[model samples]
Target: MNGEGKVVCVTGGSGYIASWIVKLLLLRGYAVKATVRDPNDQKKTDHLLALDGAKERLQLFKANLLEEGSFEHAIDGCEAVFHTASPVKPFAADPQAELIELAVKGTMNVLETCTKVPSVKRVILTSSIATVFCPKPPLGPNDLIDETVFSDPSVCEENKQWYLLSKTLAEDAARQFAKANKIDLVVINPGFVVGPILQPALNFSVDVIVDFINGKNTFNQRNHRFVDVRDVALAHVKTLETPSASGRYIIVGPATVTTNEIEKVLREFYPDLRIADESEEGTSPLNYKASVAEKVKSLGIELTPAETSLRDTVLSLKEKCLL
Candidate 1:
């Protein structure tokens, strides 16, 4: 189907990734129904409202992820839906109430809405690599981790990986519901999403870079997977446009790098900043590999380089005065 005048809904449109999805959808000339927790929050919605084609093509609807039927109206008459709302906070006063319950319940709510809304043909869900992460794969021999691997629920429980557990369960629930109802569902499992931000608030992923710049001692020291935010947004667009796109696409960059390598690159570009050295204590080594070459290559999408992604992310944060 042509995307030109078709209607699509993007839940959590005010978020870091959803905002870019909304922007790209609008640029493609789609009538976008953007659902935010509070449509009246100008600070959050203003950037979306200011997009080039948003004046008439983009519509904001107030919707809550936890509310069962909240997404029905927003999704009505839309051909596709982008579910990007999920809690990703590192710590919560109540992990279950704040993160686990919300992620699972909110996903169920969206799935229920899709069932009720008949016009919806495809649902593109934004799931994290957490769902695919197996901190300790069973005596793994393979060098590259793909979409087949999954996080160990028991390990998550034991290690207090509440965030990973929440995303894993939510995605599992979404997939099960979609399959039972015979709905077309596509999931994008992204690693650390980093790049420019179109929203007013800073993205949590950016904090990893910010922490490194601000002399924070504790952060990911080993090689970690990352994908550009813009690449992630385009992956959503591709999934919507390409009917053959199905199942899960591990949307990570082809390369992985350590935090130290990133800091070195940043230091070369911005030497005046207080970027901390790797000599800081409490840094641990990580050994993991992820493969997205076949999947992303098949989709005809190219990812941004690690250095480019890091540089643009930091510059954008500085421009927004959030650095």
Candidate 2:
């Protein structure tokens, strides 16, 4: 086992993508120290403790992302850290305090703790595609946005897109901190993640599907890049395992999909359900394509087809009686 004697810490242990990462890490034979808000909460910890290798290899630690030194106890002896916890709420009464500050401060606290821990090696930050090419830039018809391109923070703030702003600032803060402290940092920027839900409740991304099916969505009608939650998890592990992987990597499905396209697919899978056909006037349609370059492809990831991902997501929702 590649992870036979290795130890890793995963923040946000019970989250949709984080849970899958923990599962894969445990399967690889790594002793996992997973951090959550409440370790005693059965609803959150049970699913994690029930994973195949979890009984012996998994440990749940209580930590708050915003509190300094909260992560040290869990990260103390770990060789690798996967920081996946971030505020998913797009709108809040105080977006600056609740979203941006929390994300950046929490990320700094985790990195600060990592610096204190001698055993820590690499830190994998779960960033979103929103950080890249968001608030859509003016582009030529043939343009393709990649890692080098970043979302304009000023533009995001002007538009009140606080979630995107938070991710952008947080990732920037992480990069600067990692460089100054000399910590090996690898970032995984995944697009709209969809697939099975390991956690008992639905996450923001999966809820997008639910909202669509229930005709309750107010999300903008625009093209979006989609990726399976499992693929996102695998990318995190692969980035950690592959020593050569450094800097930022975009993780997304092969093609971009629109709201109508997604609804079309869902209608096929769940013909009985009344899915929404309309969307509020939102961001304009993308003029340029957004995709992953060869750098991520070099990791040898065979992406799951978008249809398969959508079908599997709904099936999982049904299994959980969420649909």
Scored by TM-score, the top model is 2
Count of steric clashes across candidates, in order: 0, 0
TM-score, every prediction: 0.93, 0.94
Model 2 misplaced stretches (Cα beyond 4 Å): 135-141, 279-281
Task: Estimate, for each residue in 1-323, the C-alpha lDDT of model 2 and write its tens digit.
Answer: 88999999999999999999999999999999999999999999999999999999999999998888999999989999999988888778999898998899999999999999999989999998778766446455577767887778887887788888999999999999999999999999887788889888888889988877775544656565679999889889999889899999888787877676777788886676654444444453244565564568778888888878888888899998887
lDDT string, candidate 1, 142-261, tens digits: 456677767777777776878888888898889899999998999999878899889877767887777767755345344555789999999999999888999888888777676667
TM-score of 1: 0.93
- What's the C-alpha lDDT at position 57 in model 2? 97
Candidate 2's C-alpha lDDT?
0.86
